[model samples]
Target: MRSFFRWLRPYGLVVYWVMLLGLMYLETVNNLPIPTDAEGAAFAQNFENDLSRNVFASLIEITCLYLILRPWSFTQSIGRVVGALVLVLLWTSGLFYVAFNADRISNVLGIHLLWLVVLNLGLVVILIWRVGRLLWRSLQQSRQR
Candidate 1:
């Protein structure tokens, strides 16, 4: 499993965002009826909308990915600190988005709610776990000295 993530680490955040947004675009556009004049416009609009709606979510997911992969284990303490700070900022942005866009949840309940809640909840858990792990390691290192 770790090896699998190692293979993925090089692809980084932008690749994942493109893949996520592409999948989202396909999902949204594929569900529609046959277009007589303008499915392109609709698809474009949906791509834009998905891009907008998911900006913070994408940021959060990439940070989660970095935490799970933990490449800074190969580098230095500064890398880890930078990664953690980036993760916290992205996670906080996601939280703020939810707080500001509460009504969006009801726009498509059930599955949508599950997607929103589960994804954000999973991110929160990952962020907490990574931070805890970092702190524990720091404490252990300090005690050894």
Candidate 2:
């Protein structure tokens, strides 16, 4: 854990947190003092969708974080394979999102996204290491038989 943090950039994390706060503020803007009912309805729908998506994303991310902390917990648990694949997809999509929208993100958040890129990379590194460990263990077990 300490080593992971050492490998990840601390300043980028700080920037990310600050950007989250800024996003929170931006979320509230929703064009206050609406001029018409149509605008109000649009705002409500947009807000609800964004809020729901954020909640869902948070849940998935938290679950994946737990797996990252206990990679071996899923070893030999065939039922968990689907969940693992979902996480892999999530991270892959996240990376693509960042890569495709780097300029837009920077313009909105006014900060470099290197920290986020590094974050995804770190998670991927853990996944690779975990897979390697599992393969080695399985190979050793086969040799012992």
Candidate 3:
């Protein structure tokens, strides 16, 4: 048990951030409007579904930033980067889905959501690139030693 805890120490930050992001995602998703089959419903209803998704994506961006700025065991840092990249990919694909199905997404949230998605995607890409560069530099320095 001690060994397990010791191994997890370097990853504690990532675990905490992931838990916080999950909680935020749950809260936001709970607040989104849900469709009901009521008589004579309007053709379009304000859904705001993507609002939660956008916020979730922002959390991912922040997580990546944290991983890049913090020092950890190399293995733990690599794990954090891989996890963040997977999340970014998932959210980016979801955003694309929303863009392609604009009629449904727009009905839920306004067109501004599309811009928000684009902005988040760009941030994620830049953060990933910067973190990758840092990791490469560190690897090269270790090799030189």
Q: lDDT per residue, candidate 3, 49-105, as tens digits?
A: 554654465556656655653535443244555555566566667766766775444
Tens-digit lDDT track of model 1 for 1-116: 99867665455344645656565545565655523335442211233355346545556656675665465453333445445556655665665577457533322122233344
Which stretches of model 2 miss by more than 4 angstroms? Answer: 1-112
Indicate whether candidate 1 or candidate 3 has the larger TM-score: 1
Best by lDDT: 3
Alpha-carbon runs more than 4 Å astray in model 3:
1-76, 102-104, 107-145
Clashing pairs in 2: none
For each candidate in turn, the TM-score is 0.37, 0.36, 0.33
Give lDDT tens digits, candidate 2, residues 1-145. 8877554433433454455545644654544552335434321222334444543444455456455444434444433444554565566567567647643222222222343344456555555666777899999999999
Every model's Cα RMSD, please?
A: 8.6, 9.9, 9.9
Off by over 4 Å in 1: 31-126
As a whole number from 0 to 100, the lDDT of residue 46 in candidate 3 is: 43
What is residue 116's positional error in candidate 2, in angstroms?
2.4
User: What's model 1's lDDT at 95?
Assistant: 59
Worst 10 residues of 3 by lDDT: 106-115
Clashes of 1: 0
Q: What overall lDDT, based on C-alpha atoms, would model 1 receive against the true structure?
A: 0.52
Model 1 TM-score, 2 decimals: 0.37
Give the candidate number with the greatest TM-score.
Answer: 1
Error of 1 at 16 (Å): 2.8
